[model samples]
Target chain A: MSLGIAIISLLLLAGKQIEEKFTRNVAGIDMVIGAKGSPLQLILSSIYQIDAPTGNISLAEANRLTRSPLVKSVIPLSMGDSYQGYRIVGTNQQYLDHFQAEFSEGKTFEKVMEIVLGAKVAQNLGLKIGDTFASQHGFDGEGHAHDEVKFKVVGILKNTNSVLDQIMTTPLESVWAVHEAGHHEEEEGKGANALKLLEEDDHHHDEAEHHEEEQEITSMLIKFRNPAMGMMMARSINQNSTLQTATPAIEINRLFALMGFGIDALKLIALVIIIVSGLSVFVSLYNSLKERKYEMALMLSMGASRTKLFILLLLEGLIISVIGFVIGIFLSRLGLWLMSENIEQNFHYDFNVLSLLIEEIWLFCGALLIGLLAAAIPSLGIYNINISKTLADE
Target chain B: MIATQNLTFAYSPSKQFTFPDFDCADRETMLILGKSGKGKTTFLHLMALLLKPTGGNIQINHQEISQLSVAQAADFRAKNVGIVYQKPHFVHALSVMDNLLLANYLGGKNQAKDKAQSLAESLGFAEHLSKKTTQLSQGEQQRVSIARALMNNPSVILADEPTSSLDDDNCLKVIDLLTKQTQEIGASLVVVTHDQRLKEVFEKQVLL
Candidate 1:
C-alpha cells in the first residue's frame, strides 16, 4: 500500500517537473526546420540534444528563411561530434544569447577550433580555460576521435539548468574545419598540412559565402516575430523543400500525451491498493469488535455513552491513515531523490521534490475518508449491543 | 438506597419475568438467591437500569430510573451504580491500574488515581497494578473488579452471579471484600447468584 502511494506521488512530482522543464526549454523557439524525417525526432535532437539528428540541410538554403518579413532570427546548428558524451553544438552567438547563457571563465570562442564549455561540461571534465581536447565523431562518446584537430576551451558557462549546461558551444566553422581536416588527413596521411588549412579557414569566416552553398548544418532553430506567420511559413517550407518543420509546442504536447497513459495506469493501481488497505482495516476492526462485544457492553453499563465508544473506534482508523500518509510521503521523497540522481547523471536534469504539491493534500484526505468509512461501518455495531444480554451471556 | 416495585420484563412474548419488591438502604447488603433459569440477573439488571422493565418503577437515590432514556440511563448508571459480573472482566489491553481508573473516567468524575492506588492496596492487588489485567489469576481479577466498582463511589453496587464460578473459599473471601468495600463507600451492595453456598452469608435474602 505504501509502495503504491509512493509510486503515485513520485510520478506526479516527476511528471510535473519534466513538463515544466520541457516547456521552459521550448519557450522561445517557434519552430525547428531540419532534414526530412520524424518532426518529433528533429525537435528532440536539435532542441533537446537527446537524440540523433535527422541528417543535415544546406546552410545557404536554411539561411534564406531569414529574408522573410515574419522571421526574426534563425540559428543554424551542426551537431555530429561530442566530447565525452556531451554534444559540442556548432552555432553562432545568437544561440547562446537565446538561452541567456552567462560565462563563468574566459570569453566566447572567436578563432576556429576555440570552444566555450557549459558549466556541467567543464566541471565534470575538469577542464580549465586554456585546456584543449580532441572531438569524437558522434554523441555516444565512443566514436572515432579527431586527434589531429584539438579544440581549445576558451570559456566555461555558468549553470543554466538547461540542455546548454550539458553541451559544448563553438563556431559553425570549427565543425566544418575539424571534419574537413580530419577527412583530408585520413586520405592523404598529411596531418601537419591540416593545421595550415584550419588557420586559413579562420581567416575566411566573414567572406565564407563563396563556399556557404556547399556547407551543411544539422538543423535550424527559427523564431518568428509573429507566431501566426510561423504556421503559414512552416507549411510552405515543408511542402516546397526537402526540410521538415516541427513546432516545439506541438511535439512536446504529443510526448506528454504518450507518457500520460502510463502515469494514469499507475495511479489507478495505487487507488486500488488504497481501497484494499481500507478493506483490510475494516475486516480487522470488525473481527476485533466481535471479540470485544462484551467489553463494549461493560463500558456502557459503567456509564460510557455509545458516541464515546464510537469515537474511540474511529480514532483507530484515523491513526492508521495519518501514519500511512506520513510514511507514504517519506517514501515518495526518497524514491524521487534516487530517480533525480539517476537522471542528473544521464540527462543533466534535476527534480525539485521539496515543494508540497496540492494533489498530495487531496490524496491524504482521500485516504482518511476511506479509513473512516471502513471503520464507521463496523463501529455502528456499538449502538446495537444489548448491555444486559451481553453481560449475562458472557 | 436502591428499591424496585413489581418489576417486570419480557425477552419475547413467551419469555417473561415478574420480580418481588425489594429495597436496600445505603451501607446495606442484600442477596437474591435463585436457580439458573429463574431471572435472578433480570431483577438485578432492572435495578442497575441495564434494561427497562415493561411494568414497574425502580428508584435509586430518590430518582425514578426505570423510565430513563437509553442515554440518560447510561449517564445515571455511571454516576450512581456499579456492577460486578459473575466473570471478572477487564479491558485486556489496559493495566489493572488503568482498568480501575476507567470507571472514574466513564462516570465523568475527576480521575482519582490516589483512590485507585489505595483501593488496589486494600484489595491486595497493589503489586499487580502495572500488569495487564489478563495476567492476573481468577481470584485477583475478581478483587480488581470489586475495586473498580468502588472507584466511582456510586450510591449502589449490583453483583450478578459474582461468585458462581469461584470455589467456596474464594467466594467467601470475595464476598467479604465486596461487602467491606461497599460499607466504606456507603453504597448498597446487591449480589444476585444461583450459587446456594451464599444462602447463609447475607442477613437480607430473597429466594426466587
Candidate 2:
C-alpha cells in the first residue's frame, strides 16, 4: 500500500513541471507573421524555435509592420542561413528586449556586418567578441558560403532559458544584403564577388523597382500596445493590409492543443496504472478477508459489529490510497527532472521541479481520491463476513 | 437480549434449512457445538443479518432484524452486536488505536477514548495501543480486537470459537473480560466453541 502511493505522488510532480514551463514561455506574445506553411509551425519556430519556419518575408513589409498605430514594437527576423550549424537570425535590437536578455559579453549589434551570439551559441561555437565567421546559405552548418562576408561577434546574450539562448542575431540589412549578395554572385559570373560588383548591379536593377523592394526581409514579429488589440489588428491586416498576420498566442495554443493529445495519452497510462494498482489492492484485501474469515467471525463474537469489521476493511483500502497519492507526486517530479534537459532544449519547457501548478494540485488530489474510492469497494468484505458461522467453523 | 423464533436458513443450492425453527435467549452463553458439517456458523450469520433466513424470522430487542433491509441490517448489527472471531482479524496497516477508531466510525458512533484506553489497559493492550496490529503478538492482537468490539458498548456479544487458539491463561482472561463487559452493558453473551473447558463459566449452554 505504501509503495503504490509513493509512486503516484511522484507522477503528480512531473505533470506540474511540464505545465509550468509551457505556461511561462507562452505568456504575453501576441502574433507571428512569416511564410505560408502551418500557422502553428510558424509560432513554434519563430517564438519557440522547435519547428521549421513557414517562409521568409520581405524587409519592406517587415518595416511597414513597425508603422502600425496599434503596434507596441516590431521584431523583424531574417533566417534561412547558418554559421557552422547554428542558425543565423537577422533581426533588430528589439528581439533581445523581447526576451529581456541581459548581456553576458559585449553589446547588441549596431553595424550591419556585426553579429550577436546567444549564450548557447557562443558556448557551443567557442566564439568571442571581435572574432569573425562566415555564414552558410542554409541552416546546415556546412552549406556553401555567400560572398564569405565575415560577420564580427559583437555581443553574447546571457542565457535567458528562452528561445534567445540558441539563436544568433544581426541587423535585418544583413539578411537582405546576404541574400541579395547571393543573387548578385549567381548572375554576375563564376568568380565575381557581391561587394565589388554592387555598384554595377545597382545600375542594371534600376528599372526592376518591385524586385528591389521585395529583396529585404524574411519575417516579422508584431507586438501590440494593448495586447487585446491583436485580434482587431490581425483581422484588419489580413483583409485590408498588403501582408498576412498570425497571432502567436492563439497559434501556440493550437500547437499545445496538439501536444495536449500526448498528455491525454499519458493520463490514460497513469489511469491504467492506478486501475491495475487498485485491482491489486482489491484482490489482496479480498484474499486477506477470506483467509481471516474465522478471525472476523471471532471478532464479531467478541462484541464487534458487522459494520465495524466492514469499516476496518474500508480503512485498510483508504490507507493504500493515501500512500499511493504521495508516491505518485514524487515519481512525477523524478520523471520531470530526469527529462529536464532534453525537454528544455527541444521545447524550451522545463518540467523538472517542485513548483506545483494549480491543475497538478487538483490531479494529485484526484489520484488520492481514486485510491481511496477504489479501496472502499473492496472493504465491503467485512460486512458480508458473519461472526457466528465463522466462529463455529474455526 | 438476543432472541430468535422459527429461524430457518439454507446454504446456496441446498433445498432445506439445517434448523427450520430455532430459538435462543439472553444471558445463556449458548454453545452451539455441532459436528464439522452443521449449520452453526450459518445460524450465527443469519442472526447477524449477514445472511437472510429463508423461512422464519429473528429479532433483537423486538426489532425484526430478519425483516430489515440491507442497510438497516448493517446499522442494526453495528448498534446491537459485538463479535469475536477465532482468527482475530485486524487492519494490517493501521495501529491498534486506529483500528479502534475505525470500529467507532463503522459502528456509527464517536470513539470514547477513555473507554478504549481503560479497556485496553485492563485487557493488557494499552501499551501497544498506538502500535500497528501487524507488530503485535497473537494474544495481544486478540485483546486489541476485544477492545475494538467493546468500543460501541453493544447490547449483544457473540463469540465464535473464542478460545480455540488460546492457552489456559489467555482463555480465562478473554472469557472473563467478555463476560464482565457483557454484563456491564446488559448485553447478551453467546459463545460458540469446541473447547469443553468454557462450559464451567456459563450458567446455561446449548449443544448443537
Candidate 3:
C-alpha cells in the first residue's frame, strides 16, 4: 500500500511540471480571421501556426478593420514560400515586433525581395546573410520552386521557442512576386490582366483602393488595445460584416475546453490504468503474504515486529507505483515530442519541451493519489497474519 | 530466554486455543515436536508473542512482551528474536544483499555492506552475495533466510521446519550450523517441526 502511494506520488510530480507550461503558452491572444473554413483551424493557422489557413481575404478588407472603432492593429500575413521545408511567412514589420523575432545574424528585411529566416530555419537550411535561396511555391513544399524569384537571406532570427523560430519572414510583396513570375496568357483569360498585375507588382504602394477589385490576403492577425473589443468585433463580423472575424484567443479557449474534455477523459483513463497497476501490486503483496504467512510467523517468533511486516508489504506497492509513474511520465513526454514535429511541418507551430501546463500537474497529482489508495489496503493486511498457525504449517 | 503463561488464541469466534505455561532458559536449544493439526506452530507463536493471548503473558529476555506498547513490542521483537521459515521467501526484485539489507534495516539491525558480505561468507553464501534470492535453490534460500534471522544477533531464534527439504546429511549440517550460530551468539533456539529427526538434535524437548 505504501509502495502504491509512493508510485502515484512521483507521477503527479512530473504532471505538475507539464501543466504549468501549457497554461503559460495560452495566456494571450483573442481572435483570428482570414478564410471561411473552421474558426479553430483559422485561429490555429494564423495565430499559433498549427493548422492550414482557411483561404485568403482581400487585403482591402484586412486593412479596413483598423478603421473600425473595435479594431486595433491588424497584422496581415501572406504565406506559401519555404527554403528547404522551413516555412516563409511574408508580413508587415509589425510581425517581427509582435512575436519579438530578434536578429541573431544581420538586420531585418529593409529591401524588397529580402528575406529573414528563423533561427531554426536558418540553422536547419544552412543559409546565412548574402546567401540566395529560391522558395518552394507553396507552404508544404508540394508546389514548384520559384528559382527565378530567388530571395537573399538578409536576416536570421534568434531562437524564441515559438512559431517564429522555424519560419522565414519577408515583405508581403515577396509572396506576390513569387507567384507573379509564373503568370502567363492562359491564366489571364478570366482573371485580371497580367499587365495590370505587372504594374501593381512593380510599384510597392497600397493600390488595392484604386483598383476595381480588392487585393488578396492569406490571413490577418489582429491585436486589440482592449481585449474585450475582440468579442464585440467578432460579434459584429458574424452579424453583417464584410468578412469573417475569428478570435484566436476565443477559439483557442474553446479548443482547450473541448480538448480539456478529451484530455480529461484521457487523463481519467491513464489514472485508472495506474490504479489498476497499483491494485495488481497490492494483490501481489497480499498474495505473497498468504503464501509466506508461516515465514512471517517464524520471523515474528524470531523477533521481527508486526509493524516491520506491514512496512515491508507496503514497500512493495511503493516500488511498483514508482516504476509505473516513471514509465508513464516518460511516455507522456515522448507523446508530446512526437506531436510537436507534425504540428511544426503542417501548421508551423512548435511545441516547446520545457513549458508545462497546469492540467499536467493535476494529472501527476491524481496518479500519486491513486498509487497511495491502491497500496493502503495491502499494508494493513500484514497485521492479521497469525504467526502460530503459519509457523506450524511451515 | 522465553516464557509463556496460560497462553490462549482464537482465529475466529468459533476457533480457540489454550495452552499451559512454558519457558526456555538462556542458551538452550529446544526441539518442539508435534503431530499434524496439534497446534505445534501455534505454541511456538505463543512463545514468540506474535499473537495477542486472550489470557496470560509472554516474556522474552526477561521482558513481559504482552505489556509492551505497539512500538515497544516492535523494537523488542527486532532486537530480541529472529525466525527461520520452512520455505524461504524473499523480496524477489532485490538482490540477495539488498534483501538482507532490507531485513537488517527493518529489523533495526546494522546495515553495513561489508558486515553483510562477511556474514554471508560466514554462512557459506559468499559467492552468491549479490545474486537474487529467487536465483538460489531451496537449500540456498534457506541458508539466506537463516542469515537474515541471525543478522541482528538476537537473544532467541524460532525456526519452523528449517531443514524441511534437506537430505539427511544436509539436514544435520543445517541443524548444526544454526545451533552453533545461536549458541555462539548466546541466543536460545526453538525449532518447530513435525519431523522427529530433529528431536535428538536438541537437549530440551517440548512435545505436542
Candidate 4:
C-alpha cells in the first residue's frame, strides 16, 4: 500500500516539476525560426537543446527577421561543434541577459577561440580559467576535432537551473571559424568539383552556400512585441519564407498532451492499489472482530457502550492509514532524491525534491477517506454483538 | 441494594425462563445456583442490563431500570453495577493497572489511580500492576478481575460463575475475594454459578 502511494506521489511530483520547468525556461521566448522541417523539431532543437536542428538558416535571413518591427529582441544561435558532450552555443551577451545568467567565476568571452562555460559543464568537464580545448565537429563528441584552433575557457556561468547550465557559450565567430576550417580541408582535398559534391551530400548545403556568400546561423530565438503577433508571423513565415517558425508554448503543450495519457494510466493503477489495500485492512479487522466477539461482550458487561467499542475499532483503521500516509510521503521524497542524483550525474539536470506541493494535501485526504471507509465497514459489526448470547456461550 | 421482580427472558417462544424473586441489601452477598442448562447466566445478564428482560422490574438503589434506553442503561450500569465473568478476560495489550483503570473510565468517573492501587493492594496483586494482563497466573487474573469490578465503587457487583474453572482451594479463594471486596466497597454482591463448591460460602441462596 505504501509503495503504491509512494510511486504515485513521486510520479505526480516529477511530472509537475518537469512541466513547470519546461514552461518556465521557455517563458520569455515567443517563437523560434529555423530551417524548414518539423515545427516541433525546430522548437525542441532551438529552445530545449534536446534534439538535432532541422537544418541551418542563413545569418542574413535571421538578421532580416531581427530588424522587423514586430520582433522585440532576437538571439541568434550558431551551433555545430561540441566540447566533450556539451554543445558549444555561439551567441552574443543577449542570450545570457535573456536567461538572467550571471558569472560564477572569471568573465564572459571577448574574442574568437575564447569560451565561457556553464556551471554544470565546467563542473563535469573540470575545466578552469586559461584551460584550452579543441572542439568536435558534432554535438556528441565523435566527429573530427578542430585542433587547429583550441579555445581558452575564460569564465564559468552560475547555475541558472535551466538548460543553459548544460551548454558552453562562445562568440558566433568561433563556431564559424571551426566549420570554415573543416570546409577548407574539404576544399583542399579535392578541387571545386569535390567541394560541390561534398556540399551536395551535406544536409546544411544551403547554410554553407550562404556562409560562403556572407555568414550563416543555425536558428534564431525571437520574442514578439505582443504574443498575438506570433501567430501572424508564424503563418507568414511558414507560407512564404524558407525558414520555419514554431511557438514554444504550443509545442510544449502538445508534448505534455502526449505524455499525459501514460501518467494518468499509472495514477489510476496507484489508486487501485490503495483501494485494494483498504479492502485488505477491512478484512483483517473483520476477522479480528470475529475472534474477539467474546471479549467485546465481556467489555459490554463491564459497562462500555457500543459506540465506544465501535469508535475504538474505527480508530485502529485511521491509525493504520495515517502511518501509511506518512511513510508513503517519505518514501516518495527519497525516491525523487535518488532519481535527481542519477540524473545529475548522467545528464547534468537538477531536480528540486524538497519542495512540497498542494496536491499532496489532497492525496492525504483521499488516503484518509479510504482508511475511514475500510474501518467503518467492519466496525459496524459492533452494533450486532449479543452480550447475553456471547457471554453465555463461553 | 439490588432486587428483581417477575423477571422473565426467552431466546425464543419455546425456550423461556421465569426467574424467582430475589433481593440483596447493602454489603450482603447472594448466590444464584443452577446446573449448566439452567438460566443462571441469563438472569445475571438481565440484572446487569446487558440483556433486556422480556418481563421484569429490576430496581437498583430504588430506581426501576427495566424501562431505560440502551444508552441510559449502559450509563446506569457503568455508574452502579460491576461484573466479574466466568473466564477472566482483560485487554491483553494493557497493563494490569490499565485494565483496572478502564472500569473507572467506562463508568464516566475520575480515573482514580490511587483507588486502583489500594484495590490492587487489598486484593494482593499490587506487585503485578505494571505487567501485561496476559503475564499473570489464572488465580492472579481472577484477583485482578475482582479488583476491576470494585474500581468504580459501584452499588452492585455481579459475578457470573467466577469460580467454575478453579480447583477447590482456588475456587474458595476467588469466592472469598469477590465477597470480601464487595463488602469493603459497601456494594451488594450477587454470584451466579453452577459450581456446587460455592453453595456453602453464602447464607442467602436462590437455586434454579
Candidate whose DockQ is highest: 1
Error of model 2, residue A98, in angstroms: 2.3
Error of 2 at A30 (Å): 4.5
For candidate 2, lDDT tens digit of each residue in B86-176?
6678756668887887777766688678888888888887898888888888788778877777788777777767787889998888888
Assess the local accuracy of residue A73 in candidate 4 as a C-alpha lDDT between 0 and 100: 89
TM-score of each: 0.88, 0.58, 0.73, 0.88
lDDT by residue for model 1 (A281-373), tens: 899999999999988988988888899999999998888887888888889999889998898778667778787789999888888898899
lDDT minimum window of 10 residues, candidate 1 chain A: A199-208
Each model's lDDT comes to: 0.89, 0.70, 0.70, 0.87
List model 4 lDDT by residue over A14-51, tens digit each.
99888877886797999888998988888887887877
Judged by DockQ cut-offs, the docking class of candidate 3 is acceptable
Task: Judging by lDDT, tell me the better candidate of 3 and 4.
Answer: 4
Question: Per-residue lDDT tens digits of candidate 1, residues B1-208?
Answer: 9998888899999999999889999999999998888998888888888888999888999888889998898898898888888899988889999999999999999999999999999989899999999999999999999999898889999998888878989999999999999999999999998888888889998888
TM-score of chain B of 2: 0.91
- lDDT, candidate 2, residue B67? 82
Candidate 4: which pairs clash?
Answer: none
* lDDT of model 4 at position A372: 92
Which candidate would rank higher by TM-score, 2 or 4?
A: 4
Q: Give the 10-residue window scoring lowest on summed lDDT in candidate 4 chain B.
A: B193-202
